[model samples]
Target: MDQLEFAYPWAFILLPLPVLVYWFVPAYRSREDAIKVPFFTEILRALNETPKVAAGLLSPKHWQRGMLILSWMLIVSALAKPSILGEVQTREDFGRDVLMLVDLSGSMDEADFTTADGSTLTRLNAAKNVLKTFIAKRSGDRFGLILFGDAAFIQTPFTADQQVWLSLLEEAQTGMAGQSTHLGDAIGLGIKVFEQNPQPSEQQVMIVLTDGNDTGSFVEPVDAAKIAAARGIKIYTIAMGDPTHVGEQPMDMEVVQRVSQLTQARAFIAIDQAELDKAYQLIDKLEPQQYSSASFRPKITLHYYLIAIVLALHLLIFSWMTLRQMFSRAEVANE
Candidate 1:
């Protein structure tokens, strides 16, 4: 805990001053009292009466005076108004559960890609390189991998185990699943995987990366995207290939655009490796998770301070009472 300000802490110092004055100040009383004794003359002979024989110190009024002084000390302490100020903290976790749908058709084997560094590489190899980095950045997010060719298959289930997912990505090869693109089946499989865990509607996400038009699948790309939207899932489509490359059909832009519009998602065209990297970076920004935080202090103990104050007050009161009793006995003997 921390102190915001001292309202009137200095007033506490006056607590002891009142008690000191009470100890020194004498209580004066003016009253007439007549006591008839059988032998008044003999009593006067046995006892000595003195006006200033420490009678103030020996008076019963000292006890009553001490009580009044203690009351004032309590009042002063109450006026000091000591208080404590503190802080509170809170934290929240928000992340996306993404399913990566990759097209593993024969066209992906075409060697017509150039990295941003101007290095030549196959389309599949360049994609793997950039995808590894993207997977590494999603620390708290659960991810799954799907490879679609003539058929779609789950390479990895939804998990936060990025290392396992990256290893599976490295093993990906052209025509490993088959020689044709099944875009619709890949999305359908993605939906099934997401349904297994049933995450919050807003957190479910799907990203489709393909190098050619869909040629295999019982379902169509547009219909799959519509189903995804109805389930509150967002789909991002990426078309990967060069339009000018010989014997390489340009990516299916029309299908990609239609799917994106139906799902309320964005479509990206990566003609080369540099564009592929930028596409992933754009998705990273667009699907970012929201976060919130708050801070507070740990608990502190204050029992010792309270105990000390009580003990000190008790000692002071006990001392005053004992002194008053001694003074009363002395006054009676002198009379």
Candidate 2:
């Protein structure tokens, strides 16, 4: 629990107003004719009291005076608006949701991606390196991962935890799911994952990276792209390794281009790490990081409780005075 604070501390200045009035203002009086009783003088002499009582002060009993002062103090405190202040916390509003659909076909093992330092890495490793950098730069984006080859598998669901996402990404290996490429199945799986979550994302994006044509899939790649397009999901395609070469694991440049075109996104052909980095850089620029932050403290008001206490005190004092007066009247009647 945090410390109590007042909304209007200046209200305390009114606490002494009643005292000031009592000291300076005179009591109200009215004139009346005195009774011409035969024993009035004798009664005053026997009681040893004077009869010159033209004016008198209306003073309350000690208890009544204390209660009145206490009630006034309570009213002032309520007027001040006491409240408890809570600690401040921050919240971040994310801007986008990005899903990466990576291809882990056997062809990805080709050691053809040469970096600027004259070092060679497999296609999957190269893509992973570029992706690590890219994902880090996208600060306010929720990311999900889909690895596909013989079959498609979701490695990580949508999350803002970048470290956990990267950890899952590292666990992926070439041909782990299967050696054959199933681009259409992967796309379908990605769409199904989005449907299952159904969480509202500001912007939805899917980046598809592959090195081979769709060998066998229940749904065709272009048809899957059309479905994704209708669902407002943009698909960016990346064809790894030399696009011109035709071998056992042939690159499907046409399919990649068509998929990107149908979904209103871009396509890239990366033969080296530099080109891969440039592709991610372009996408980063296109979908720039956007977010906002705010801080606030919770407040609990206490004035209502104070008002209730004042009401209870007034009722207590009223009941006590009423009972005392009733007993006093009964005693005089018995006498």
Candidate 3:
């Protein structure tokens, strides 16, 4: 039980006031009525023979009086509405470590993007749209971001603070991390970030988004994927852009698939904004790991309602008794 509102319980001191009133107040009694008869001896005999009706009706037994008093006290106490409070606890399940690896290489600048509304957009703009929504939906999960081109670096550390991560993402731009894709280095750096966090039994996640093949990196893509697999990291790859366009080379889907197979993850080819959106939506369906802490104040209260009902019942009883006494007196006066 918990108290939703009251701050001080000392207000209950007023409860005793009603008890004191009930204890001191005198009970109602009717005035004595006198009767005269011609045969004094016979009248006295008759009076002795008659049952003591007034004593039985007007003055109840001691136990009955006690019951009335007890009933009143109970009613008053109920009005006080005492409350008891306690704490409640709950646990959440969340287990996947997520790293968003974005390719900021020069090739990502290709204008092959179109919004869901049919408006033309840049690849960077389209990626941001999908990524922001994805981040927002992952509550209670630890996440990080990696941006790579000529070099790879951790843009944000693994954290549960989605707002801060999204803010850093908004500031991310092409060439800010350099203008050539280092796919292996990006994956390797993502692994390093995840390594810093505590490892759970479930697999960690690496989502790599790239438009071009690996052009700059000391590490090989296959070797990076092997390292990630050995560490139980699942890699989901997204290859962006239309391969059929002139001067646009098709991304190495076989290499991407090989990496996915090695790391026990999936690979996706997003030729346009719509495909990218669908790919991300699929990832969103996969739940993330969560951790949480809660604080509580407990209380219990039901006295007020009980008291109200009791008081109303007793008031009705008292009114009926008073009316009966008045009618009896009126009948005697008429006789």
Candidate 4:
């Protein structure tokens, strides 16, 4: 509102057009200039002492012509399209791009974890429930899903639609990717996915939930974590399984901890459902909400005011002409 501007500033070229026309065009010429004076006496001069041409030049019509010119200027100014712009206000957006790397290996099918309802659920099911809540809390953030076992693959691409992401997460089944856990390959694949689009390091996050150590991977887990750190991608690793008893898939705490430390993140050992929930809660705290601001200024058109001024001047000219005509008719009737 403080500054005035034209949407189409080039239209200002028409502003001087009326002035140019008046300067370049010739004045009107009359076919006849005088009336015959047959008598050639002082009586004809006494009838009209003032010269008609000189009298016409001094008439009030000159004032009307000046008003017409002013009206034209207002019309041209309106056509130029003027507007007022307000101060820019910044809108802050708080969100982060999260890529979830989940283990869908055969061991995740273990129903050792129980829910708060005392009902039994598979490790994968418990993970799904916890993740559902976690993602729900991240309202404005974008999310992606990656499932890995013997081979790592992207289950869902990055998306902001929570419903769609949750649906995809629910669709996952154990051993869909493979029977063995390729923890390193999953991390590498996640890094590759993040690199494809690529955001600031602070804005990018990868959460890995696995029940076992790496069985076979083209890249080593620690090496992949180093790459993630160099690229500014934070990695939070959660080892979900009992570390005590030996099983088909044993949880590796050392590798997970190193991955987290290298990326300036925390490593969690989730033995049961409660521990896993707590781990996710800690991650939620560790990664604070990110805020980004964008500035924008609103604009309003002011051409209507100029148009109204032009209209008012023309109406005044018309009203004055009508009143003069009415007065002349009344004089003629009296005569």
Which has the greatest lDDT? 2
Q: Assess every candidate by TM-score.
A: 0.58, 0.70, 0.58, 0.67
The Cα local distance difference test for each model comes to: 0.77, 0.88, 0.76, 0.84
**What's the candidate order when arranged by decreasing TM-score?**
2, 4, 3, 1
Which scores better on lDDT, 1 or 2?
2
* Model 2: per-residue Cα lDDT over 134-203, one tens digit each: 9998878989999998899899999999999999999999979888889899999988877777675758
Worst 10 residues of 1 by lDDT: 49-58
For model 3 the local lDDT of residue 313 reads 70
TM-score of 4: 0.67
Clashes by residue pair, model 1: 88-295, 89-295
Q: How many collisions per candidate?
A: 2, 0, 15, 2
RMSD of 1: 10.6
**CA deviation > 4 Å runs, candidate 3:** 1-94, 198-201, 244-249, 286-335
Candidate 1 stretches with Cα past 4 Å from truth are: 1-94, 198-201, 243-250, 291-335
lDDT of 3 at 153: 86
Model 4 clashing-pair count:
2
Q: Model 3: which ten-residue window has the lowest total lDDT?
A: 49-58
Rank ordering of all candidates by lDDT, starting from the highest: 2, 4, 1, 3
Best by TM-score: 2
Per-residue alpha-carbon lDDT of candidate 3 for residues 203-226, written as tens digits (9 for 90 to 100): 588999988777767888989999
Q: Can you write out model 1's per-residue Cα lDDT over 1-335, one digit (the tens) per residue?
A: 37533357797788778557768975665554355568776766678743232222354488667655666655565566544554555543537788898888888887888876777887788788888889887776778899989999999887778889889988899899898888899998888887787454358889988888778678998998889899878899888775444113555677789998888889998878879989999999998854334566534434344445656877887898899999999999999
* lDDT by residue (tens digit), candidate 4, 1-335: 38888777777788778778879985555545466676645755778665445212234377777877777777777887888887788775647779999999888898988677888788899999999989977776788999998899998888878999999999999989989888889999998898886443348899999888888799999999999999888999887778654225556678889999999999888878899999999999887666566899878788899999888877887898899999999999999
